[model samples]
Target: MRLLRDLTNITFLELDVTSTKSIASAYRTVENQTGGKLHYLVNNSGAGFVMPLLDSDIEMGQHLFDVNVWGVVRVTQTFAPLLVRAKGTIVNNISTASCMGLPYQGMYCGSKAATRLMSETLALEMKPLGVAVVIVITGNIRTRYQGGSYFSSIAERIGVYARGEQGHPQMEANLYATKVVGDVLGGAEGTIWRGAQSTIVKFALAMIPTWLMNQLAVKGTGLDVMEI
Candidate 1:
């Protein structure tokens, strides 16, 4: 609220990415406000779950994908015309988890990975049309969305196996401490993965191999003890 009041140029529009009707309405508003041309379209809606894939409900995963993956596709498709009119850019906020899958965060990672791929494809398709598509793959930057059931549910499940300091050494430290700026475009081409420790972590994950990462994730989150 304070930011809204302080920012003279910023306008807040109520948008529910999961709802086509809401997106359509917001698009109309933006079109009217900008006279049918927009400079940048940013899709940042996301949801997450933090339980083992087996324990996590399929519906929960669906919901996450709805907001994180499909929502970006929806918003981008809806606004692509206006972006083309202005030769603007489309930016999707993805996550590092998309690149490096982590235990207890597979659903979120999967959804983000989907969006990341979608953005890459969109970038290629939009290039000829002069509409730049950019992806911002973020690392842990605290936000309210990080709270809620996933946190409690994950903590409880981990507590069951993480008792008495017997949990993996990784559990002793914050699971996601490396904050990163991630992908950002400079001249509307190529991807830039920035932010703190992003280079080191990216190199390590790439060199370590997928199987090793999975094993590390299982132990790190104490998911190795989960039965069935």
Candidate 2:
């Protein structure tokens, strides 16, 4: 609203990325407003979840993929026609987690990884149509998203396993891994250095051997004990 106060050409449309009907409506609005010419379309809607793969039910897993992966597909498909008409570009906001899998957040990582691959394929497939696809792989940044959704529930479960003093080695490993990742992310609300630190980590992860990267992920995210 504040930005609209100073800008007259900008328009905002209420969009639900997960719903095709909603996406179609948004596309129509944009088409009508801009006369079917779109210079750039960015897919940035995503969801985050924090829980062990074992604890996450199918529904929960599906929800994560729906929003993070399928939503992008829906939006892109809906707007591709307009983009083709304008010979525009599509930018996808991906994550570094997509590059390397992380424990506890496996579902979220997997969804993002799938989206990255999809975007890559789209880049090649749409090139002939003069539609350029660009993907921005972001590392950890300061945001309040860590506290929303299932964060508290997942944290509580992990906490129970931590304080119970039970002889469960897996839970113990999970507790340790969770703490390590939490520290790396600078806990819930990240610090100013988070963006830079995460970018460095991504660079490091990319330069290392795949096996070494997996080993680090296993130790850091407690995926060593997780059964595939």
Over the stretch 1-228, how does candidate 1's per-residue lDDT look in tens digits? Answer: 454578778888889999999999999999999999988787867886766666678988898899999999889989988999999888777777788777667788899888889889999999898988777656544334433443453466655432423232231112332211122323544444543345555787769987877786567453565432
User: How far in Å is the alpha carbon of 186 misplaced in model 2?
Assistant: 32
Candidate 2 clashing pairs? none
Model 1 scores worst on lDDT over the 10 consecutive residues at: 171-180
Give the alpha carbon lDDT tens digit for every residue of 137-192 in model 2. 66544334454433443455444433432232222323433443444333221111
For candidate 1, list the clashing residue pairs, or say none.
none
Q: Which stretches of candidate 1 lie over 4 Å from their true place?
A: 147-188, 224-228
Model 2 segments more than 4 A misplaced: 1-6, 147-195, 218-228
* Candidate 1's TM-score: 0.79
* Whole-structure CA lDDT of model 1: 0.70
